[model samples]
Target: MKKKLYLLGVFILCVVTLSGCIPTSEKKSDTLGLESTDRYELLIGLNDVGTGKQIMDTQEAIEIIKMKLLRHVSGVTITVSNGYYYVGAFIVDEATLNCVIYGADDESIAAVVNEINSDMNVSVLVSKTPSKYRLITP
Candidate 1:
């Protein structure tokens, strides 16, 4: 009886996984492809996180960046990385932070990334985030 129950559980797990019943934490692009236009993402580093020789307070950096980006652009989405970065969202933490900025046009994205990288404590890595892979999550 125990063996049969274990097999049932395994079968249920496979069904759920194959049927796409599992949920993922990463926010997704729009289902309608409204944000299908060209958008970019900026992977940001700061202080030691920025340049190898630089130094900074992580929280302070996040605040400064949030304010600066907020002023220049209203549509940008910024997520703080826990001293590391992934392609998309994850559970946040209190440790040193990195940043990802996405969902904007080429010119706007370039302008903001340049603005942030111009700061002595920050450096920016530019990459095209395909709208299909990650755009405005619905």
Candidate 2:
């Protein structure tokens, strides 16, 4: 009986010790490249939609657009300049997709022309402005 009990305890100790020694998985994911985010830095020139004259050259404008786009995400800071805008959006692993709108809260480009949307593209109205400028992601 003593031998059996001693063997059982040793087995239990080995199992416990070996379990802690196992290595954990360190896997990453790749879905949408846009979703992963980058040290993204792009410039959007503010030219008059009509005359093509430069209206504003500002990092502030870029910062505003960056903040508006990534307000709900984590680990992002946008810098704007007079000549162009700079963006570095870092999405946390927990972020989820949602339609985000900013500015006069209008779904129109008039509310936010000369601005860059999340697709990292410039947004301009072809005709009369819509109700608001919106960013939608899957």
TM-score of each: 0.49, 0.27
Give RMSD (Å) of candidate 2 vs. truth.
Answer: 15.3
Local distance difference test values of all predictions, in order: 0.60, 0.41
Looking at model 2, residue 101 earns an lDDT score of 34
Tens digit per residue, CA lDDT, model 1, 3-119: 999999999999988879766689965666564444455556664533353365766777877776766655555676644444356532224334344455667766767777776
Q: Against the true structure, candidate 2 has what lDDT?
A: 0.41
Error of 1 at 12 (Å): 45
The lDDT, on a scale of 0 to 1, for candidate 1 is 0.60
Candidate 2 residue-wise lDDT, 1-138, digit = tens: 999999999999999999999987876543423232122223344444344344443444455555654543333333333433333563212111122232322333333333344333333322322332223567
Minimum summed lDDT over a 10-residue window in model 1 is located at 91-100
Q: Look at candidate 1 and give me any clashing residue pairs.
A: 46-50
